[model samples]
Target: MCESPVRHAHSLLFVPATRPERFVKALASGADCIIVDLEDAVAEGSKDSAREQLAQHLPQLTPGQLTRTVVRINAVGTRWHEADLALLRNWTMHGATVMLPKCEDAATLRGVAQKLGDGARIVALIESLAGLDAADALAREPHVVRLAFGHLDFQLDVGIHATADEPELAFARSALVAASRRARLPAPVDGVTTDTGSAERLAVDARRARAFGFGGKLCIHPNQVAGVNEAFGHTEAERAWARRVLEEAARHGGEAFSLDGRMIDLPVIRAAEAILGG
Candidate 1:
């Protein structure tokens, strides 16, 4: 699989491609990645303009900013897909990742990979039933590095109206996470929180997504970055416990030991290491 920028990103912020002025602001928002959106966020008539605007602004991004920037282009079958791909293939250093929305097959991704070459990396946004069916193949694709859940569009397509708690999407969430792990990909990214003004709801959603084994989440606004980052970050208590677990395991070397009345072993130490590393 190709390298993934999202593999290390805990908070992904979206900025409208038409809004060039906001590009620098989004990059400075403390978000791990900034997605310059030319899909849902841009009006149909303005797509060409937004595309041009993005090309102009992208080359201006500093090297440090390039690694944190992503471009969310239109779906594969759309009118803008070819043009977007052309720009992406040519502007290799503009961004580290590309978000391919509504991916339902590997063929499209294969074509994208071929067009973008090895320099530009891609992430699949699985948002439809076809996507759910093809996720395994998508995750295993050579150029496809990570999977991201697009819950709002997904629910609308499936005709499901879920409550604020999100219990209805549980099975789907678990399936994607399992698929990513089975394919040895980074934990999938959860969808965005629509409640931009409600930090309470956003934090709740972020925490829920993190518990569901998601490595990161999409942020529609700058303010959501802090909460999403915090939700995914290891707490002081978790870090302290992980340190202690490692210390005890080192004393025993390769053998199993008991700590705080609980068993400490290779599997236990590995889990602690994951927390510390994250």
Candidate 2:
């Protein structure tokens, strides 16, 4: 698989494709990836105009900004899906990223791969029971770079009335993470925190995602970027510990050892490497 810029993104911010003026600003919002949303963000009647807006303004972005940007097309079975793919033809050839919403099967992703060809990178959004059940298959798709949780729609689809903390979705979150690991993909991205105005809520959500082994959180607002970034990032103390662990491992010739009364084995060494690697 080709390297994906969003593979380790900590914050994926959404900007409505209809609002082209905000594109540059969203890219500058310190988000690791900016998702240009053409799915839920655009009304049914405005889909075509939204594509037109993107066609006109997307080219204005610098190559670097475009590299960090992802275009979220309508779901596979939606009326606008084919048109969205058509609009993305040139962009995909130039190494653009695409996020497929409500991805429930490998065949759908295969179809997209055929359309986007080799240059495009795909993020599969799991939002329904069908999607959750097929998470393993979806993750194993060669073109899929990562899996993302769409918790809001997922809850509705499964008739789950989850609370703010959303403990009910734990199983689904773990399933995605496991599937990604099995497929050797980066840790999956977590769903968005709908309460955009609450910094505390965003922080809690981002941190909770990190605890669940998610690499990133989706954000509807630019304000949520810093919180997500901080949550996914390692602290100075964590870096120091990771460095010490590696030094000790080297001294011990990569064998198991004890550090601060805790066993520093292969698993611990790997964890330390991941922390320092990021």
Candidate 3:
């Protein structure tokens, strides 16, 4: 199995695969990862054309490229699944990860895993109530490496009242975080902010998601990428505090220690390690 890279403090920017002109520029953007989206972003008639275009560009990426590449395919139960799988099978791209949308069970994942063999990785997008309920089982599937929340579809599926604060979707977000932790995966990715240029609003949303234990946030535009990265990356103060707490604990023979007069223990150490990408 290929081990996933330690992805602390990174932005995954989504680009519509059908827009061939956007592909090179997106990959060249400073974002840590580029997700060529074949779902939500692409229209019905354009899906196959997008797949073919992606196949042509897949080989153009050189070794040791700075940005990691991923493909967001349509939901498993949708009509697009077979073509997406076929494209993935014949491609020779390096470090390609598939983002499986609307994943609701382990069986669906097992099928994809069998197709990808053991070398490829799958990222699950938990979008519906059924998928949220099945998250633990889904995460345990052999091919799944990460889980991401699909807030828009989730809201529609659950009939949640829409608000800027997203109060109605809080439970689903919490469930995703808890399930991801239980499955020992990296922190689940938060959903996108539709506004392309509103950095202040994006920062607020990103910070809120980070507070809820999300390690990353999705982006609809390149402008949103930097803000998401800034929100999720460890602050200097955080790094210093983590180091102090660890050093104090070590000095005390691995016993609990006080940092700024607050008790710090194993959980604190683990969280510090996560932030520091240790």
Q: Stretches of candidate 2 above 4 Å error?
A: none
Q: Pick out the ten consecutive residues of candidate 3 with the lowest summed lDDT.
A: 1-10
Model 2 poorest ten-residue lDDT run: 1-10
Clashes counted in candidate 3 amount to 0
For candidate 2, what's the RMSD? Answer: 1.2
TM-score of each: 0.96, 0.97, 0.91
Clashing pairs in 3: none
Quote model 1's TM-score: 0.96
Residue-by-residue lDDT tens digits, candidate 2, 1-278 = 44668888899999999999999988889999899999999999999999999999878887777778899999888899999999887887666789999999999898998898778689999999999999999999988889999999999999999988889999999999999999999999999988889999998888888888899999999888999999999999999999999999999997899999999999999999999999
Residue pairs clashing, model 1: none
Q: Compose the digit string of candidate 1's lDDT tens values, residues 1-278.
A: 33445677899999999999999899889898898999999999999999999989887888778777788989878999999988888665444678899999999888888888777677899998889889999999876678999999889989889899999999889989998998998999999999899999999999999899999999999999999999999999999999999998888888998888999889989999999988
Best by TM-score: 2
Q: Can you give the lDDT of residue 158 in candidate 2?
A: 98
Best model number under lDDT: 2
lDDT of 1: 0.88
TM-score of 3: 0.91
